[model samples]
Target: MKILSDTIKNIALEIRTGKTPPTSNHEYFGEEINWYTPSDLDKGKFLGKSRRGITGKAISDKKAIVFKPNTVLIGAIGDIGKLGVTSDFSSSNQQITGIYPDPKKVDSQFLYYWLKAHKQSLLDKSKSAIVPILNNKDLGQVKILFPEYISDQLLIANLLSKAENLIAQRNDSIRLLDEFLKSTFLEVFGDPEKNPKNLPFTTLEKLCSVIVDCPHSTPVKSKEATNYPCIRTSELTNGYISWDSMQYLDEDEYKKRTQRLIPEAGDIVYGREGTYGEAIRIPKTHKFSLGQRTMLFRPDYKKTNSIFLWAMVRSEFVYRQAKKKNSGSTVGHVNVKDIKQFRIYNPPIELQTQFAQIVEKTEVLKTQYQQSLQELENLYGSLSQRAFRGELIKY
Candidate 1:
């Protein structure tokens, strides 16, 4: 790839802290400006939509500068190297820096992706005293390679845009499939809202082994590696958990930390709160252990199939029940007490096995669907690298 040395910076303004913001809306005292956070960005680069929005009035007296719709927003802290571009007019908090690229000298789209591709490089220099942050000086100095002329830049952007559309279509398909899976669950079990069962419900603790969430006191952080599976809420895509996005854990750390709850093959792990009610069966590869804020369920083989238990937990009725019992001022969470009382339907073991078979079948198909989508994503990535290298054949 040819190297172009020109650089870009965010609108040069003095840094302002949140409490001493340059602007503020008196109505919402705690609201930040309609700014996007680092956590809002996805690896896929399509920032679907964000629920958090701040306004000019909210940032009163703070650095209330606004970013133009065309500029790309970069994460400068905790979540390193997340890239977001505006679809509508917006501004961001101090955690994010709005990049006003020199579009005349560089393709903003290309520069955005190039920064995305080299996110780690940006992150490496994002070290700060109290928090990890990308400094303005480094961001402006970062060089981007470009084609000899604007036409080449346009050509590259068009190709990437094509791949983006394909990826987006596949994303939509995946979402559609997820809806189908929810429908399937309803088809299998009667709808929770309308069809509240008169059938007897049993306490989860009585039906199976209930492991409480890990201690939140202090967690041993995994040092990231090239390839080892780590599970967090972010990896759960749609209704199913995608293991591919996980952080790699060293064997020693994995074994040491999760030793007490190195889960069994059929164990069902539950994400206890926030985006709660997701339960994933332990695939043989990751039958390792539990993380903080996660609950592990080991079904009694004679009474239930693990898959049946998974469906049972995720059903609308269960989520409603979980929601009702949640506590906390800021974020509601399901604790061991709440989980112990979670009701389970004591249907015949035969029916449990049957449902397990169906879930397994769905999983098999889902795996294939996920693999195809993943392959397309990989292909797009490979094409991006090749296109940058000038190795991709011009069509």
Candidate 2:
């Protein structure tokens, strides 16, 4: 076993801390800098972008410290151990501390992943009354499995860098798919503003029929194992359905919920509740029943291409339209009637096929990208588990 111990004085670092200073004009808190909160730690390892930003003057008035892009951003409050690298120079909440390596002493990526892999442990070691926090004093004292060889750190960094590249590619593919949809809509329908088509484009009722939701509510608790799989809208992704996380209903339960939705091949299932208008095409291979939140529109295959319809659902126009017809006050929902009444521009078969081809090709590439990401995540999981366990050699 390799044993290495080192201690260094790690002082607490913070941005402006203290109650909001009241100013005579209320302009003191005007120029606030970007402050990432603990809730922003959901990106897992690396945070490329942030949601909130404060004013620049706020930093000066509050004496908030500016974080360098290379520094390790660590949360000190409730989320005591979560870690990320400040890709873009930015400030963090008062409870955040920037962990700077002693010039070339550590790889930032290595540090981020090390802390991320050991997040729970750091949490356990922290001491706090109201909220868990690892003060600056304890931050440097916390010993991690630091390699004596810098080469080992660089090697791991390279591997992780490649993994990061794969993730970036996946993100790009997703963006491109969205772009293709946007482009397809513009090509087929032309800008609804510039040239509102003179084609026989009318109410969505003309295209297909039968837009239906599942059982009005969640199924009653039952233990009976059914022959069919029941899936919810939450499970759909990018027009594909995954049965890996599906629930199995018993025969009796299925018999009782007669309205339970059965997805037919080419049936486009849409999310009517949370992610309203988000839809997935039910491939023939998808053998399952739809849950309550899922609304399946069995399009007349002869009139409308299900693939085209699924792509349309992902468009901004349909999303806004669905939101408009939503029934509930707080949590919006879409019903069958609302869906059929929704209009669609009927392009020629050639145009429909051309758009379908683009979507189809992009989907295939997306599937490959998804698989690559999953494999990379799994590999990272294994590598991290082994590395933290002292199983990884100092290569």
Candidate 3:
């Protein structure tokens, strides 16, 4: 494979950063032009409409830079590797580094994919500060390895774009499954907020065999991967535990941490501090101890199942109730006392168990979809790597 490489500065016509208009002046902000920040960069191929915009006054006042169409935007601040290409004449805040790629030297879409594939390399060059940041100089110095021919660049970009589209389709499938389960939950058990069925209400405390808080202390995480995972609030997403992202601890630390209650299958882990009230049931195959700001709920089979309790805590009604208890705090949080009093619509045990079974089956399907999505992601990564290396093309 014959590949050519050059610093981003050498390939681009210009490298520039943006600025925010003075907040004291209200006239400087409006919908006159699209303005982006780090959060707006969602790894999308093109940067279009943004969450906020700046008026012409801001641009006229030299507070922002207008990046032309096909200009690549890389996150230059705390989020170092977020990549996107400008779809129109757009402006952004200081967090974005705008690159106008020299059309003769590199294809815009190819540059986007190449940067996407090597985002970690950009991260490596970032200055390790409290919040990691990449400077324009460092960004301009990023080495882009590419085919000398623009036709090959376009071909490689198109191939990788197809792979990305497949990966995206797989993600959409997984998300649709989640939406299906959520709707099904509401169908089986009427909206918790509405309580249209007027089902009998019960406190979570009564429905559970055990409601215990995680140890207040932080676990000393193992530098190397270990079997003993310490589950944190970050790992709780979409009613599932992201086992892969969990921090691990030594066996001794794990034992010490689980001294209060070792989380097992059928137990619900609830986040209490940061993202208060998000909950997920512990899977049957995994064993782990709770991290900070989390509590465990063990459903009493006689009253409710783990699925019911987990869903209830995540429901709009219970979440609103939980928020009410924490309304006074500067940082939102739920305490054991408040959690114990949370009222929920409690249907008959037979009905709860039926719903539990339905959820269990749906989860199994979701797991399969997730596995497929992982494989697609792996394929996309491999394709991106090879496509940029000149291995996917023939002269």
Best by TM-score: 3
- Candidate 1 per-residue C-alpha lDDT over 1-395 given as tens digits, one digit per residue, 9 for 90 to 100: 34444545432222221222433344533334455666676545545455566555654544455666556777776776777666656666677776665566666677677776678678767766677867777776665566656667767777887887888887777677667767776666557555544445687777776465654533354566433455565555454556565566567766765756666787777887676777777777653555556677888877777877777887788888888888755776877888888877776777667767776777777677778888888988997898777665454
Task: Encode model 3's per-residue lDDT on 116-145: one tens digit a residue.
Answer: 888988998899999888898888888889
Descending-TM-score candidate ranking? 3, 2, 1
lDDT of each: 0.66, 0.66, 0.85
lDDT of 2 by residue, 337-383 (tens): 88777766676666667778877787787778778778877887787
Scored by lDDT, model 3 comes in at 0.85
Please report the candidate that would top lDDT against the real structure: 3
Q: Which of 2 and 3 is the better model by lDDT? A: 3
How far does residue 375 in candidate 2 sit from its true spot (Å)? 2.8
Question: Where is the poorest 10-residue window by lDDT in model 3?
Answer: 326-335
List clashing residue pairs in candidate 2.
31-55, 31-58, 32-54, 32-55, 226-249, 226-250
